[model samples]
Target: MRILEVEHLSAWYPSGRTRRQVLEDVSFTLDRGQVLGLVGESGCGKTTLARAILGLHRACAGVVRHAFPRPQMVFQDPYGSLNPAHTLLWTLEEPLRAIGTGRKERRDRAMELLDRVGLGPEYAGRYPQELSGGQRQRAAIAAAVIARPALVVADEPVSALDVTVQRQILDLLAELKRDDSLSYLFISHDLNVVYQICDRILVMDKGRIVEENDTDTLFAAPKHPFTKKLLEAAE
Candidate 1:
């Protein structure tokens, strides 16, 4: 079933006096429990589209309709996204607390999520500064899902990590999707990683969707020149 429908969406940024288009008439649907990969180079408007969908961006027009719980984001840099003063437990519990989850339940859920994300009990009291990059990212992932969101917008979630850590985080995300029946708007320039996790792929070029297809078909025979270049670079 369709969980989201983004129709004729567009966004523009102020450019000196006039406006410059960043996203141009983009339209797509995300079904329930689907992982949709959005791949593009820098300045391709992938991020702008994601922000618009999350209601975090202005200067946009058109419709963004969804039939699901509120969406959350897992940012590229946990160091910057997470509050340094807050412990990982506090960070994870904040979401639950926002909707009137009791203190005891918040604590219990936080600890459970910490364990679920492969972080031990000892890590709970530690601040974001104390954890490694991978650990922080894991905590971030836990926080994003703590409120039982049906959809998540993960923008370059593993780009800053080591190769090994990237694989681990991807596997964690895959498992979470399976367990939670979650959908993802996974934004990244990394084609190989997208190929590994995404069921379908949308390729962006010059602020528009240049190509889209199922994972295997998109990789086997890319129709767009820009998509071909992306695959070649990934190889």
Candidate 2:
């Protein structure tokens, strides 16, 4: 099933005396349970594409259609994304509470979510500052999935962690994808990381997608010059 479809989508930002286009005629589709990687250098409109898809940015033209309910986002900074003052349980319960879940059910669901993310009930009582980087990220992931969102937009989800921690978080995400049958719009500047987790890759340059292909095909033989440059840089 097609979870998301974007056709001729465009976005622009106002600059000095003129409106500068940040996304131009961008388009793509994401299927249920598929992992689509959006790869590009900084300021290449990668995040703009994500924001537009999530309705965080206003589009200039075209359409973004999705079969799912509102999608969730996992930001780059784990610590910053979470509330510093709230307990982990409280953080996880916010979504459930928003949907009118009862107090007893919310507590039970929060504990279940913690278990699913490989954390224990004890950690739920701790603050964001009390946990390690990996633990905090795990909590963030748990929060993102607690509501069982159909699609998740993870923008550089593991970019701030150490190499070992990065692997752990990536593994956790992959496991969650399988367990939940979730579709992900995984955004990153690192081709290598994307190659490891993404089924397909989209290469963005300036403000457009220069190339896109299955992960194996793109890695073995990149067609576009910009794609080749990204591959070379990754190497």
Clashing pairs in 1: none
Output the lDDT of residue 101, model 2: 89
Candidate 2 lowest-lDDT run of ten: 57-66
State the RMSD for candidate 2. Answer: 1.2
**At residue 156, what lDDT does model 1 achieve?**
94
Could you tell me every candidate's TM-score relative to the true structure? 0.98, 0.96
The true-versus-predicted C-alpha distance at residue 43 of model 1, in Å, is 1.0
Per-residue C-alpha lDDT of model 1 across residues 1-235, encoded as one tens digit per residue: 8988999999999999999999999999999899999999988998899999999999999999978767999999878888988888889999998888999999998998899889988999999988889999999999999999989999999999999999999999999999999999999989988988999999999789989899999999999998989999999
Ten contiguous residues with the weakest lDDT in model 1: 65-74
**Alpha-carbon runs more than 4 Å astray in model 1:** none
lDDT per residue for candidate 2 within 19-42, as digits (tens), equals 999999999999999999999999
C-alpha lDDT of all candidate models, in order: 0.92, 0.92
